[model samples]
Target: MTFSLVGHCAETGQLGIAICSSSIAVGARCPWLQPGVGAVSTQNITLPALGPQVLEHMACGLSPTQALDSALTRNGYSQFRQLAAIDYRGRTAHFSGSETLGCHHTLPGELCVGAGNLLAGASVIEALVRTFETSGGQLADRLLAGMQAAVAAGGEAGPVHSAALVVVGELTWPIIDLRVDWADEDPVGKLAQLWAAYRPQMQDYIVRALDPTQAPSYGVPGDE
Candidate 1:
């Protein structure tokens, strides 16, 4: 009951994933990213540890295909999982095991890969990759657009309750990580709204973390 896309932005050297699921808190479990390494999404039965494991493999110089193969090989339940990864070089890979849920598919594109299980149809994944590859602007914007397009085309087999968008740049920490853990309706839309609100302050937050004295004021109470 999950659909996800992992992408790399060549212009800015950013990597990220956008995901939606019928389950609660999909963000807390699925997406994994290392600033200069890559992005990975582990869903469909969701072995959360596999996200990190795959990233570790990528960090050690494996291609997305090899990293996924190495990681899944070590797992006892590989056949129950669905995964996608994109490396810093924009190379992509994906896998949908034999036991994936209804209407699963994977679409690999220039700088992104979309994969899902228990989806409405293969069109959902196609929409994800197509929109991501064609859209313009920041990595976060393309990711959000891809997700919205997928929902517009046809989402999961049922209503999705959780959505997450994560983007990592040069820092060890993510530049953008937004989630709507559980929403009765339109979780992806809610996630997009969060990204909109966070966008203007995203770089400021990074500066604050690195050097607070040079950072802008909070504009609240005592800071004024």
Candidate 2:
């Protein structure tokens, strides 16, 4: 019921994940990332705890494959989960459990891993990897492009009701975290709109958090 991609921007040291699913609030459950660690997506039977556990392993200096392998070994229901991870160095790994629903696939790219369960076909994962590889822009833009390509390639087995994009840079908090938890129409498109509106002010908000006197005003009520 979900399709997701986890990636790293070697040029900027950024880690991010983008996901969409037929289920509601996929964002809250499927994606996880730490600024200097790694990114993970846990879908299918969706053991949400596995996401942070994988990140913790990567943070402890384990390679993405090693972290994923260790995490799966501890899970008795590993066969029912679909997982993907990318370490801080852009090393990637992915697993699609034998019990995953519908036509599922996983593709590991140069600095990313794409995974899906209950998907349209292998082409969806392929499109995600191709878009992320060829698309030129910020890490957030590339991640969004990958999600767009996934939808263009037919997306999940059913209409995706929720979508999310999360990117982490130097900040402890996510630099970009946007979601359409549930939408009758296209949640990915809705999330894209939110990104467009937030991108320009992203640094400004960070500045406000770090030093309000140096922060730029966007003519908001308190600016005067």
Number of the top candidate by TM-score? 1
True-structure lDDT of candidate 2: 0.91
Number of clashing pairs, model 1? 0
Candidate 1 collision pairs? none
- RMSD (CA, Å), each prediction: 0.8, 1.1
lDDT of 2 at 168: 95
Candidate No. with top lDDT = 1
Predicted candidate 2, C-alpha RMSD: 1.1
Quote each prediction's TM-score. Answer: 0.98, 0.97
Q: Report the lDDT tens digits of candidate 2 across residue range 61-89.
A: 89988998999998778889899999888
Backbone collisions counted per model? 0, 0
Q: Residue 106 deviation, candidate 2, in Å?
A: 0.3
Error of 2 at 144 (Å): 1.0
